[model samples]
Target: MDLILDFFLVSGIVIIAIILLQLFKVKHKELPQKVLIVLFLLLFFVAIHFYALLHNIIWLIHLCFLPNDITTTILGPLLFLYVKTLFLKEDGLVKNTLGHFIPAFLFALGITIPTMLFNIFKIDTLAYTHTNFIRTIIRFESLYFTLYLFISLQLLSRYRKLSKQKYSNLTQYDFNWIKIMFLSALFIMSIDIGIKLYESFWGDLSWNADYISVLCMIVLVSFLGYYGVNQSKVLLPSFLLNKEKALNIEKTKDKTLSPNKKEEFETLKHKLEQVLHTDRPYLDEDLTLGKLAQQVSTKDKILSTLLNQYLNTTFYDLINKYRVDAVKEKINLDSYKNYSLFGIACECGFKSRTSFNRIFKKHTGFSPSEFKNNTL
Candidate 1:
């Protein structure tokens, strides 16, 4: 058990250190990246705290410089902010959200600082550390973690929905990594809370279950390091920020369009189809609703409303539908017979084979190869 715990502790420390170095080397850091760096730094301190505790390093533990408890308070806020900064395109987002860190700040001031001062004065801090008040505070921290994690997951879901509306290719903007991270954190938090509750009622178990949580943390850290390093900033458009307005628009979709408005949308839809069929703008792998709107000579919001209300489709579905049709057309051609399935998919503006297969199957109920075979 000791051997396994040592391995996890070392692995977690090394993973966090490597990620920190990588983040530090970034030439230009955005708000999300900066938040991510701080997030990992706190994780590093967490790793060190566990190491110190496990090794019985009295001085290191007593120093309270790392303040693992404070990190528990801070991490939740940092995670929510990371998701927010990734999706929201607002000025001074980090600065404006400084209030979120107040709990962590107060924790450091009330608990960690006093502990450090006691250690400096060679005072016994056992009375303060082992109190019922501290235990209650720890429980509250667990609740705090739960609340922020829930909020982050909710925000991620909304962002994903909005992304599908605006961007055709969701490869870069998917934020699946963030979802995985939060889910993993949720798993770890559940384990920790369960164990704590068990200990509160039944006293400590013979074996340490914390080692399991620590091992999971190591794996989670490695996962975050790999994906976080490659993650691009997801700056949502200004219109997307107003989610209330978007919701109102969705609510009004059932309302009948005025005849003039219906005619206007009909003309716009005709022009949109003409441009898509003639110009083949969907063939751009990075095509977006705004780009397609420019090609169709209409505002993106109008184009969006046209697709949503009149066509009974989304921008993503409409664009991908054309691409799939183009693929089917190419597949049926004699000259394109020698082209590989992936080759045909790429030529039809499908960015990746996985997306192509998934989208093709979604639309035609057959994989790309199956479709080609049946048609041929």
Candidate 2:
């Protein structure tokens, strides 16, 4: 009991310390900080309950009296919330936020209420082995395991989707913390299950090993809190054109490289413009600066410089100008009005209705429909 108390205290302090720090880590928050906060609080709850059990605290002793089972119950909900928060904040999937826990919570109630009633019904057997509670916890712990595996799978899917997203100036912020968290959950659940299994088959012998699991969990929570509290710099990826406008100084390199830099840049710009003119490659779905640079035998850095300084526009803005011109020409022809603005956008060069409207409005000071009504 003393050993268990020590385990709970160490882990408990770590848990609470982290949470307090996270509350201080305000201003420019992200998924990582939120995750860390939740983790710290959850561990604190688990550790406190266990510490109470070790001391046979009366209110706790009367209220269910099973430290391990109570902790087990809380774990499932905490983890469910963790995963749900992750999917909601990171992906903006609002529908998925609270819905994922209904099935798990319902199934847990099946195990929890039944196990409690059954224990009351069988005090004789419980007294002999001191592990009737352990047997009961197994069923719910299995549910927790399945929930965790589901969360891991979902995270992997999100990782793949994020990899494919365009113009994500977001950086990977400490996925290592998440990996450690998942592994810590696995280890604790394993110990809980292992203890129950051994007590059921071989009889309750020792409680020494549980301390190791608690310490591991505490360390995990403490680390998560540290990561939460630590200051992470944001890249603040403002649009390049906006940034250039604000800075206002000439963007060209100092002590200009003779005529060489300008000449090289002009050649590359002309080559890309030629392709842009021919294939109307600006219309292609994946026509990024890197892809365009490859075709034109130039670096994106050099092309960007030339486009901004000489053409007086960003590559995105420059590409959209052609699209706008195409749309205007089509609208000028009475035959084109038969189709809608969405149709006209596709005919011009846009990939989606939203992208078309965004770029069109930026270029032409009106929505596609508004521009068409005024001009066409």
Candidate 3:
């Protein structure tokens, strides 16, 4: 058990070190960097909590004893915000959404004020006058974190469905890693809740339980690092909103296309295809609905509506379709016979090999290598 605890402590330090390197060593500070900083700070507190639990070092225990265990309070909001940053256009915190951190702030104040008066200032004889109150808050905070975990899952599910509706291939903007992390988090939190229940009902717990919690935390950190580092950026044009607000948008958009405008829409759809073929805008790789609209001298909303209603596809899908066709043409060209399949894909405006391969397989029945071999 001692060995396990020691290993877990070392693992926490290693994870923290890796996070620090990522934060400072990277040249550009992007959304992912900002997300990592949040994760790092969260784990830093957890590590301190673990050290305090071990009680080997007197000063460490003193430092942690009165400090608010606000880890749970902040973790949920941070994670949910991280997911928001990944997919939403306005990734930063908004005025209305700032209330999410209110509970965390309240917890910090609740813990610190009483502890300062009782422990540090010695104004009260008791070391912790609000022991029962603090314990109750901690219990409720566990449940609160669980609620946020569910909220995060819902947000991810919503975004994923919306992504499919907006994009043909998910490889470029997939958040599968984040999904895995959230599920792992749910499992970890369940274990924590169970332990907390045991402590509440079954009296004192063994050191082994502490060891297990620390080990689980270590696993959580590993998940964060692995997923957070490799995640690709996602560009969602829609405004970020809460679940209720997002549902309202869906309801409003449910109104079908007017029959009177169907003929004009078909004409515009035909024009869209002609423009796409002649301009070959998909070859630019960064082609977006607005950019394509500008190229075709069309309004963004008009193009969005045309793609969604008339073509039964998204701008992303329609663009990728053209890109796939272009790649097929390039692959068959005599001048490109010597080019590697990936090179051809890149030339055809596919940025990621994973995306290219996945989308190619989706469009064609065979893989790139299979197609190349069959041609031979």
The best candidate by lDDT is 1
Q: Write the per-residue lDDT of candidate 2 for residues 1-376, one digit (tens) a residue.
A: 5775676576566658657665656776665456556545555655765566577674653344343444544555555555444423355533455565565465445544445545556545334333555355454565566466557746644442332221211223324465666667676667766765776687766664555666676766666566546534222112332434323426554434357776776777678778878877656644565566677777655655566565555565676788788887887687875888878777776667767787788888898889877974
**TM-scores of all models?**
0.92, 0.47, 0.79
> Which sequence of candidate numbers ranks them by TM-score, best first?
1, 3, 2
**Best to worst by lDDT, what's the order?**
1, 3, 2
lDDT (10s digit) by residue, model 1, range 254-333: 37588889889889978988898889999999999899889888888878778876776778888899999999889868
Lowest summed lDDT over 10 consecutive residues: which window, candidate 3? Answer: 245-254
Collision pairs in model 3 = none
Q: Candidate 1 at residue 83, lDDT?
A: 85
What overall lDDT, based on C-alpha atoms, would model 1 receive against the true structure?
0.80
Model 1 residue 241 lDDT? 57
**Comparing 2 and 3 on lDDT, the stronger one:** 3
Of models 1 and 3, which has the larger lDDT? 1
